[model samples]
Target: MKTNFNKEWKKDRIGSAHSGENPMVIAKMRSGFAAIGDTQFLPGYCVLLPSKAFGSLEELDFKQRSEYLLDMSLIGEAILKVCNPRRVNYSIYGNTDAYLHAHVFPRYNWEPEERIPYPVWQYSGEKWRNFEYQYSDKDHGKMKEKLSNKIYELMEKAY
Candidate 1:
């Protein structure tokens, strides 16, 4: 069964036996990073999508899953390196999107407002950064460039 993650990716690359989207256009293991939306509100908001679809991490082959986590770690490193927020948050719940993607978010301790574990749905005077907007196009591209370059550098050195 085709999943949501790969679908959007399909609009972008499909792999061989691999089920990743836009495998060609998408950044390689070491090419760069891709920002989902342009909202600059959150500096390092990225989704390290799996090359293929499996309901959960439990389904992926041990080696492939390990490598993906490593990649995610490298991606996370670049994210924190660039954003430098108070701390970082990683979310891998595939409930809504139903795609194999991980959320790499930079959490700040001194944020203007209080943000809880689950994002509040009501927009009522809520700061959009936590709920909606995060990265803006003008700055996001440049930031993505930095993060992407870092990933590429790490990828080159290792794999």
Candidate 2:
């Protein structure tokens, strides 16, 4: 099975998703593509990238907006089934990426107590840079496949 896509996938995420080159992609939904995140600091972390890049959610029409939100939550549901995290947190901020995308983070009970009630960003920067948390074929392939398969199943039920 495919592991994580190459780093170059970031240069054209939406395009890569469309071309079927983004190995990180879990599934393509009505409004966008759901993909595994670069870092697996949170095992089930994923992102929803619109089929076409838009600067913000406001750029999308009402139907597109609703579809995007629905697709994002569908990804969260797949994460819930695959990773079994305590809960999932969804966030949309295009500040860094400069495009419309939603992050789906699965919050786990096993996380440090101090950070449990806080956002995932509360984790030290080291958490983001640490190699152990980085995605690798040996480390994350199985879970990614599980997530992809579950998402396909859920999407089938959803649409």
Candidate 3:
């Protein structure tokens, strides 16, 4: 499927995923969609978007919650394999988006010594908006392909 680089998917991430309009989507997992992040400032960053929209994790029943959490971790593992960062960090904060999407960050040891200890959010706004850090198929396509394949491989092994 073609990746829609335009901002059309911003207004409706989950809906766009359902319609296959979100360019960031890497794979459709059992519980949600595994998508590359909008910014590549931290390469291999990703988000786990639920197939069905919900305000928070608690909105799901026990089994569904388990699947979602497992999917999140699996993506983290995939990131570890593909990105080869020092480690992976998983975060689910509905504060800004108010949706049940989890962030899978591949933390690297090469990051600035001062910022390495802080959360990805602690980065400057300029880093987030810098064109160099933005996600593009040209710069990130190969890695995304590897990550997508690894996610599928891990999923198969997982189940």
Best by lDDT: 3
TM-score of each: 0.68, 0.93, 0.95
Clashing pairs in 3: none
User: Which model scores highest in TM-score?
Assistant: 3
Residue 30: error of model 2 in Å?
Answer: 0.9
lDDT of each: 0.57, 0.88, 0.90
Model 1 lDDT at residue 112: 48
Give the alpha carbon lDDT tens digit for every residue of 1-159 in model 3.
233456778789999998998888999998989999988888999999999889999999999999999899989999998899999988999999988999999999999999888999999999887777888888899999999999999999887
The model with the greater lDDT, 1 or 2, is 2
RMSD of each: 6.5, 2.1, 2.1
The true-versus-predicted C-alpha distance at residue 9 of model 1, in Å, is 6.1
Candidate 2 residue runs with Cα over 4 Å from true position: 1-6
Arrange candidates, best lDDT first. 3, 2, 1
Ordered list by TM-score, greatest first? 3, 2, 1
